[model samples]
Target: MTVRTRLLDPAVARAMSAVSAAAKKGLGDPALAELVVIRASQLNHCAFCLDMHLGIARGHGVDERRLDLLAAWEEAEEVFDERERAALALTEAVTVLTDGFVPDDVYDRAAAHFDATRLAHLIGLIVAINNWNRVMVGRRIPPGGYTP
Candidate 1:
């Protein structure tokens, strides 16, 4: 597919950058953060993001096996820890909103694993990735073009 735009309008791009920077600062665990991003990108079917984030995730030392099983995280408890599972559950709940709004139980599970500050950061990361997914998908940004 042809690209629709090289970048979003300047104001929107700046806003997105700000959000991204804030999310990165808010979350401390690079590996966990990448998992959240990768999971959300997977759910959104954003190939550009998947390609980019997979590399970033690896750079953060996330395991190859975990990355391979991210799409099936629910069934791979042996590979994912409780914190990772909770984040994955939150990612699904937020990404698949049409399936239903995020359930309280899912939120509670994440809350149990993370304190309020980190929980907010996790939510921020989720929202930002979803936004990026929609923008890249809308632009038909090709996968494999991103370097990391």
Candidate 2:
């Protein structure tokens, strides 16, 4: 498929990248944070993000089974811990927003697992990934386009 020309300003893209970096860093748990973004990309069907984050996650020593079972996280209770399940649930709730809102149960579960500051960073990370997913998918950017 032909990739569409990028319509977003270079500065805006740079800002978005910075937001993502900051959020990930602020979250302070590399393994959990990587999985959060990866799950968000999976839900949003962003191939470019999947390519970038999957490699990053693996590099950080995230389990192959966890990555493979991410899409079916709820059904793979044996693989993901309670904390991870909560994050993944929050990721999906934020990514889809099917009812135009995040369910209280999902938010509460995440809050129980993460303190207020980390919760905020987690939300920031989820929001950033969702936006990035939409932008990349809109531009038809392929998986291998991610350089780092």
Report per-prediction Cα RMSD to one decimal. 1.3, 1.1
Instruction: Give the lowest summed-lDDT range of ten residues in model 1.
Output: 139-148
Candidate 2: minimum summed lDDT over ten consecutive residues — where?
139-148
**lDDT (10s digit) by residue, model 2, range 21-139:** 89988899999989999998988888989999999999899989889998899999999999999999999999989999999999999999999999999999999999999999999
Misplaced by over 4 Å in model 2 are none
TM-score, prediction 1 = 0.94
Task: For residues 70-97, write the lDDT of model 1, one tens digit per residue.
Answer: 9999999899999989999998899998
Candidate 1 stretches with Cα past 4 Å from truth are none
Candidate 2 accuracy as lDDT: 0.92
